[model samples]
Target: MATNDYTAILNELKGEITNMVVSSASAYADAAKHDAQALLSDMDANLQTWTQQLATGEISAQDLAFLVKTQKDLMKMQALKQAGLSAIAVDKLKNDVINVITSTIIGKI
Candidate 1:
């Protein structure tokens, strides 16, 4: 093949790869946001249930113990969810997408 043909093919492949990487990054961001929101909703529901139980005086000593344990579990889950949404991996993926986009633009220039 000619040199120009080879270069064109390479350019096309690079553009395709860049689009795919950007789309994947967007998908990751969307999924992470959804997971974080779901966790928050779960926490809110748990709080409501706990509040109602307390208001009803249905919380005996054993119930209080269980509620404390549940609270700790929810706190741990919230921390994990937050970490997952803002983790190093997500940051790296974001950087990679940005780098790919920049490279593609510069390459075209």
Candidate 2:
């Protein structure tokens, strides 16, 4: 059996996260934008699996949120770190990304 394609939903999430990072860190827009893409890229495989599970009713919204939050520990956002964004700023950006992920996931359902 073929798995359902989730490219559109993932793309939508990527666009939202990229836009949010660029706007939220105007001073480091370029670096932040790159970070956003990298973060999404790192999460790509898990996202595909989770999104598919969510769509198939194999995972709850809460499960998706929790799973995503757990991935935060793995998010380095190297560009943001190298660009001298404060720890607080990086944390905020991570939170924003999580929010975007959750919101985007739910909105698509």
Candidate 3:
């Protein structure tokens, strides 16, 4: 192939790769956001249930407070876990993209 042909192909490949990376990253972020929201909703529901139980004499005030504190701690841990997973996912995506681009360029040459 001519120089121009190779250049054109490489440019097209680069554009496609860029689009893929952007779309993938957006999708991952959306998924992470959804998961976080779901977690929050669940925590809210649990807190409500606990409060109701306490009002009904099912649990003592001390127990309620402890439960609430424990739940809050769990939520914090879950959030941290999610953030760590997100970071790992982003790193993996970066590495995968780099590998793909490198292989493509190597093959082209």
**Which candidate number maximizes TM-score?**
3
- Arranged by TM-score with the best first, the candidates are 3, 1, 2
lDDT against the true structure, each candidate: 0.72, 0.77, 0.84
lDDT by residue (tens digit), candidate 3, 16-92: 67887788779878988898899889988998999999999999999999998998898889889878987887787
Error of 2 at 14 (Å): 1.1
Clash count list over all predictions: 0, 0, 0
Off by over 4 Å in 2: 1-5, 27-85
Error of 1 at 10 (Å): 1.6
Q: After superposition on all CA atoms, what RMSD does each candidate show versus the true structure?
A: 6.9, 24.0, 2.4
Model 2: per-residue Cα lDDT over 83-104, one tens digit each: 5675666788899889888886
TM-score of 3: 0.79
Per-residue lDDT tens digits for candidate 1, residues 1-109, read: 5678658757876777677667766876787778769877876887688777887897665786687688778778777876776676567666775676577556665
Candidate topping lDDT:
3
Report how far residue 84 has shifted in candidate 3, in Å. 1.0
Query: Lowest summed lDDT over 10 consecutive residues: which window, candidate 2?
Result: 1-10
